[model samples]
Target: MLRRTGIPLLALAVFAGPALAGCGGGEPEESAADLLSRAKTTLDDASSAHFVLDSEGAPNSGTLLVGGEGDIARPASFEGTLNVRALGSTLDLEVVSVDGTVYAQLPFASGFSVVDPAQFGFGDPGALLDPDTGISQLLAEAENAELGEERRVDGDVVREVTAELPGDLVEQILASQDPSQAVQARFSIATETGELRRAELTGPFFTAEDDATYTVELSDFGADVEITAPPTG
Candidate 1:
C-alpha cells in the first residue's frame, strides 16, 4: 500500500512542476527606447487630451508663466486658463486659440482680444498636441533613455523614464531663456495604455543663472472636446 501511494504522488509532483514554471513565464518587459516610442505614437494618435502645467523654483521677479490647465484638440485648438506672475502678482487669464489665432481676456478687460502668446512669456498652448512640434517630439528626441521603477499614479500603473532633451526642442513648446542648456526630463507613462501621464523638466527656462522645474500632467485622451475662437467684442 505504501509503495503504490508513493508512486502516484511522485508522478503528480512532476506534472505540477512544469505547469508552475510556465505560469511565471510571461512576455518580457519592454525596453526604455521601445516604451518611449510606443508612448510617442499613442500621443500622436490621440484626437484630444487635457493637460495641466505647473512650475516650481521660479525667480521671484520678472514676468513669468507659472501654471496652466486646459484642453487641446487636434489640428491646433486650445481652451484654457494661464497663471502669469508679473510684478509679484499672479494673474489668471482666460485664453483661447483656434485657426492660428490666439485670444485672451486680460484682467480688468471686458472681453477676449487678439493677443500674441509670446507677450505672456509662453508659446501657443494650442500647438502642444501637434504631432510634429509637441510633447510627442520630446519623446522621439529623448537621449540616453532609461526605464525606472514602476509606480502608481492617479490609480494607474505607470513606468518612469529618465532622459535628456535638447533645450532647443523644449523651447518650441515652452519659453526658454537659454536654448543651449540641456533639460533633464522624467516621463511617467502608463503601462497598460502607453499614454504619457506626467512629464517633469528641469533646466534654465526663465534665466540662465538658475534652474527651474516644470511639471506637466496629461490625461482624458480622446475626450469629446470642441474649441472655438472666442469673440473679441
Candidate 2:
C-alpha cells in the first residue's frame, strides 16, 4: 500500500515488496514471463488462506492479523484489526481484504476514510490474493524478472523472484517525482507457490538519517470476518 510520504521511491518499495520478497521460481532457465505466469497460477489455485501483515514503516511496527475465505466461486473478504501507536498515543486501523478497501478510524481524523488499496498500487494482497481480478494485469506491468537465492519462510525453503518494474509502473510512480530524486519499484514473489510473505519499502521517504525500510507480514485466519463501513457524520 501507499507509504506515508509522497516519495515515489518509498511508495514503490512498500507496494512492490511482496513481489520482491516472495515471488521467485525453482532453478531453471526461466524467462520473466514464465516466472510471473507461474506465480499467477499458484495464486489462482488457492481457495483460502491467511497471513500476518507486519510493517516496519513510519510511526511503528505491529502485526496486522489477516484471513480470507472463498475462491472464484463465492465472493468473500479477508479482514483484520491492528492497534498502531503513532506520536504518543495509539490508534486502530482496520484493514479489509475486499479489493483495496481499507477503513481507518483515527482519533484525529473525522472518521474512517474508505481508501482504495490500489493507492499502494503494486497489486496489494487485497487484489493480488483475491479470487477475482488478480495479478494477471499487474504481471503484465513487469519489465524484468530474476530468480534469487532460496530463503526460509514458514520454516520451509522457497525460491525468491524479483520482478523489475516496467516503464508504465515507473511512470506511474514517477508521476509525483521530484527533480532532485528518482527510484524504481520491484515486486518479489514466491518461487514455489507464489504466496506473498513479506514486502519492503525503501528510499527517500525520510530524511538522510531517517529509516525508509518497511516490512508487512501478511496471519490470523479461520475466524469469522466482517467489514462494516466506518460510522459517518
Q: Which candidate leads in TM-score? A: 1
RMSD of 1: 1.8
Per-residue lDDT of candidate 2, residues 1-233 (tens digit):
56546688877899899887666754556565776676556555555445443333343332221122221211344455544444444455554545345554445677666655433322233443443454334454544556666677667445555554433333232111222333233345565556544433343332333434433433222234444435644
lDDT (Cα, tens digit) per residue for candidate 1, span 1-233: 99999998999999999998999999898999999999999999999999999999888788899999999999899999999998888889899999678999998899999999888888888888888888899999999999998999999999999999999999889867898999999999999999999999999988987899999999999999999887888
How many Å off is the CA of 82 in candidate 2?
5.2
- Model-by-model lDDT, in order? 0.92, 0.44
Off by over 4 Å in 1: 1-19
Which candidate number maximizes lDDT? 1
Q: Work out the TM-score per prediction.
A: 0.92, 0.49
- Taking all chains together, the TM-score of candidate 1 against the true structure is 0.92
